[model samples]
Target chain A: EAGVTQSPTHLIKTRGQQATLRCSPISGHTSVYWYQQALGLGLQFLLWYDEGEERNRGNFPPRFSGRQFPNYSSELNVNALELEDSALYLCASSLLPGQKNTEAFFGQGTRLTVV
Target chain B: SQQGEEDPQALSIQEGENATMNCSYKTSINNLQWYRQNSGRGLVHLILIRSNEREKHSGRLRVTLDTSKKSSSLLITASRAADTASYFCATDAGLRGYSTLTFGKGTMLLVSP
Candidate 1:
């Protein structure tokens, strides 16, 4: 089975611009999650979508938003991006949300560089 | 404000040696997982230890969790140059569901051949 896949392996944007990243989860997975791994900063949860619904979010701002499609793929959008927004955006997929011990497979991630 | 905090921040060891990294969390968790990232690439799931389980092993990796201490440790035996990567510990907590993983800063491991 193919694993989670992400688009635009690397991206470069400027301040105040908008950036969009994409992720396709593994087959048979129902939960899609997004995380931001900034340089020197660890992986931080951004958003969680389950069955096409926004289930939970992290401590990020509203500018960081995303949605899960019917096929379980997800897109992360950042509006009015700041230089600090430059980071690696990762997407993961799980069999189900809230199921303890289920491993989440991650994509290669899209590295967004805000200039 | 990270949930799991790995100690030492960074480590450098020789091949055939052992590497041990520790993680501490503040809140209760249903399961704690470990992941390895090569360079800045995507993270790969390494192991997961449930709250009820104290110890688990996968090939060359050994993980131990102590709910009482609210901490966990990951040990890699006979480390190789391929094991040179960043290791992070994540927690699955809260009632909102287990999909969200709060990861730590991770420990950067460098293995010399």
Candidate 2:
């Protein structure tokens, strides 16, 4: 089966501009999660969407927001991007909650470069 | 932060040897998972150990979790060049019925032939 898929493998945006990253979860998956892996910053959770609802988010600012569509695909929007916003944004998908031994599958991620 | 922190930020070992990495988290979790990420690639799930479990093994990988200490360890035996990558430990806090994961900074392992 095809794993999670992300669009525009790489993106470049100028400071103060906005950027949008997209992700399509694996088939039959209902939960999509966004994560930012900035250089030397590790992997930070950005948002979590389940059943078309925002379930949880990390300590990131409001500028980092995203939404999940009816089909379980997700879009992450970074508003007024800053140099610090440059990072590899990853998307992962997993089975619905309450499932036993649930494991998340990740996409290759989009490399966002903010100048 | 509830994120896990990996020990020995980086490690170098000769191929065919064993490599071990440790992770410590700040909060109680429902499960702990290990992931491997090669350069410029997405992470690959390695193993998952639940809070109730102590140790588990898959192929040549062994994972041990000490809930009392809120620490976990991963051991890769007979390592190969293919094993060189950054290893991260993620915790599923399972807070409010959400399976959200908090990841560690990761340990970089380099295996030379």
**TM-score of only chain B in every candidate structure:** 0.96, 0.94
lDDT of 2 by residue, B1-113 (tens): 64799998999999999999999999888899999999957999999999999999999999999999999999999999999999999998865333468889999999999
Off by over 4 Å in 1: none
Query: How accurate locally is residue A3 in candidate 2, as Cα lDDT from 0 to 100?
Result: 95
| Positional deviation of residue B72's Cα in model 2 after best superposition, in angstroms | 0.9
Q: For each prediction, how big is the interface RMSD?
A: 1.5, 2.3
Write down the DockQ of candidate 2.
Answer: 0.57
User: Model 1 Cα RMSD, Å?
Assistant: 1.0
Give me the chain B TM-score of candidate 1.
Answer: 0.96
Please, what are the lDDT tens digits per residue for candidate 1 over residues A1-115? 8999999999999999999999999999999899999988899889999999999888999999988888888999999999999999999988857766788999999999999
DockQ of each: 0.71, 0.57
